[model samples]
Target: MRPRSCFVRSSLLLCSTLVFSGTVARAEAPAGPQAPPAPQAEPAVEPPSAPQVEPAPSAPAIAEPAQPAPVPAAPPATPPLGPTRPKIDVYVTAYGELQFAYFNYGLDQNRAGGAQRDSRIEFDTNRFVIEVKGGLPDYGLEAEVEVEFEHGGTGSAMELEYEEFGEFDQELDKGGEILVEEMFLSKKLGANAALAVGRFYVAVGTLSEFSRPTDYLGTNRDEAETSIIPNTWDEMGVRLRYKFPWGLRLTGQLVNGLDSTGFSSQLWSAGGHQRRFEVQRATDMALVVRADVTHFDGFTFGVSAYHGDTTRNRPKADLVKSCEEANPREVAPCGYVSAPLTLLDAHLSVRKGPWSAKALVMYGHLKNAELVSQRNARLSNLLGVIRTPVSDNALAVWGELGYDIASVVGLSDSHHLFPFVRYDYADTQFKPREELYDNPRFRRSVYTVGLSYNLMNVAFAKLDFGHRRLGSSAFRPENTLRFATGFNY
Candidate 1:
């Protein structure tokens, strides 16, 4: 009886649940006005209630996946800057050479100490140079300070004790002190005109005006021959130059004369005679004029002249008295003395294809007072005053013939080389010889064979073999071999 009652209860509960679900589904369907609807199928069977559609089981909760970060693009690269152009350069140039030299003395002089006057090999430093150049090639300024060697001999080398000043003073004092080589500025004024000022080498002659070392043929100027014109006579001054359309040019300068203190004679300076002859002050001046003509294709010619009063006319009476008393035979007393000098120079060059020829001539003269000494005795010693007379002056002449053999080898201008032969003769009559001015002639002649190469514009290299003979003396064997390289940029 208990089991039956439980079965009946379970049946009743299931029936009720079914009925509830059916009613809910019916309510969810579309509804119409209450009417008796006809079923048209042969055997109408109610379609199974649409299968219940339910939301998908809730997915496991998940955080959104992190997004990857974007990558950055690379930047462009830059190139290095190149060296600046047309810039001013203040640089040091170091170079040197080993030299072998031979000296030939026809007659060994008496009283001279046993100083090696023969063959020798010399190595020298301090031939180095420091230079500063600004501005453009059209117009600019250039300067150089050279090193002087501390040890050398006349036979093999020149010892520049200063070891600072260069082969050329550029700027220096008479006592071998360096002051300034080039303190001047230059500017281009026109298509063919320029101007310059400051301390510079006087433009009084062809040989003295060359600023390049490789262009020179000899070591030193003839002191006697060049005394009147004075090679390397530098002064603080101004220069103006102009080029013409017809291959001609002209240059002029106004410069200070030599100072009183620079004169070789102390007595002249003490007596106030030195300054009395020339304008005296640093501003006391002289004039120089030069004309150059280049025409007929490869031919060039030049003429230059200079005149100035290098002294004041004031001669000390007492000094003259003292000079006469000291060297009565050598020095003669006079009331008035002249204080002026004049110079003339000319040169010509012809360059035709592979051959070039050049010739130069120079003359110099001193005015008024004759040379004398302090001992009332004639200063006729070779080193003393006796060399001069009315016609006792200075003259120099030289010639060079060069051929560009390298041109045949198709060398370019920069690499172009030339083989040259040259001859130089100079006579200094200032050394007094009483009779017809015979004994006192200081004469020298040199023959040179060399090859020169143009390294660049305003730069060159030279190798030369020289045979020097002094006043009819025999040639020295082995002679001298020299090598030089120089540049101005």
Candidate 2:
């Protein structure tokens, strides 16, 4: 640009010199001829023009490219870290079972479906369950909910017990109970620890794992537990659990306890479940502690115990009832008798390759059974002379072993058939109350043989035979044939 300016100035000076020369020539009287103006193109040229055309601004535009590339990179780097999240998950699983059963003999005069009763062969729906689980990753919280349908009927109603003395009846509902068997909230304490609250299955025996129909090999949960203890015993509670590095776990729970008023000669503490009425009494609380060792492959051994005050858990009526017509011998129904219950159980489970086996034995003791039985006898029947005897101690034991036959037959891994055998013994009246004679009818044992099959990882089927005996050979034995089918996830 400087060179152009210099050339223009030099040209102007030279043009002035030429004009003077021409003027001099003209003035000197040479022929008057003005040189025609040379053709001019600079009229259209404006080298210094609008602001947008400045070359200095274009230099900054090139520099802007350097900063903006990193500007976009900045947003991208943050997005990869800021917006990412793990998915909060919810899962659903379900299981159900159907059974066809035939009893060879009647359990008692009042029972149905036997040679001496109403029907021998019958079809029934045992259990159906749908489970939902949810997790909140950011909050370290989780929840589980279980919905169950039993007996396969539907209604806008539910059946319940009419809580009254001398009443052995269920407020009848012609509909199935859609029960919320389990619902709980849990928090992760660490990698191998957790704390939970709400109504959930109690950790006492194999029931925690074998509560689902498909988890056990036999046609039903072994008879011993179902007879002496609460089957799938779930209670309102808080639980703490920790897992050790060496395949050992320890757990403790504090929960509401059973009602001694419902504990009887027949059902023992099993009837103490407070489902007959709303609002269980928490006046009597139980503490349960369990320890399990799984250090050996395919083996788990555990022991659990509980202690609670059962008398305080009863209905208020039982505490103050003084029926002169019923109990002339005693003034009142063992007025607030201090009956505490203690339960201890040991369990073992094994699963290695194609073999599955489990064993559990539970013993329960009640303090002041003489008093509890005396109160229950009059409560159940005030006018009757004879009364059902209650026991001071109860015992239950069961064991089962199974083997998978698919491998032996060269079948695919998805196919399975396990032939198993099991033995169960339960005596709610293991130790009869003092001053009452023990009935040989109280202690019972069952021997079962079954074949269980699986299909497509979804469905299961079972065929089994059961022989049940009461007391010694002096009592007649009961026999049963059963078939069961179900699907579980």
How high is the lDDT of residue 486 in model 1? 45
lDDT, candidate 1, 1-489, per-residue tens: 644444444344434444544443443211332311312221222333312322122212222234455678778667558844665656554333233333433233221231224554433331323344455653354444443332222112112223553221122223222223445677777778878877666666654454344444333222223434444455667888899997998988887654322232211211211212222244346788999897568777899887665443212122233334454444334432334556688887676886767677877654533432222132213212222233335567777777777758887766657788888766655443354333222455678888767655356666777765555333232256666554544
Mind giving the per-residue lDDT tens digits that candidate 2 earns over 90-156? 9999999999998877656323321253348978887799999999878788999998887797424
Relative to the true structure, how large is the alpha-carbon lDDT of every model? 0.49, 0.76
Judging by TM-score against the true structure, name the best candidate: 2
- Clashes by residue pair, model 2: 113-119
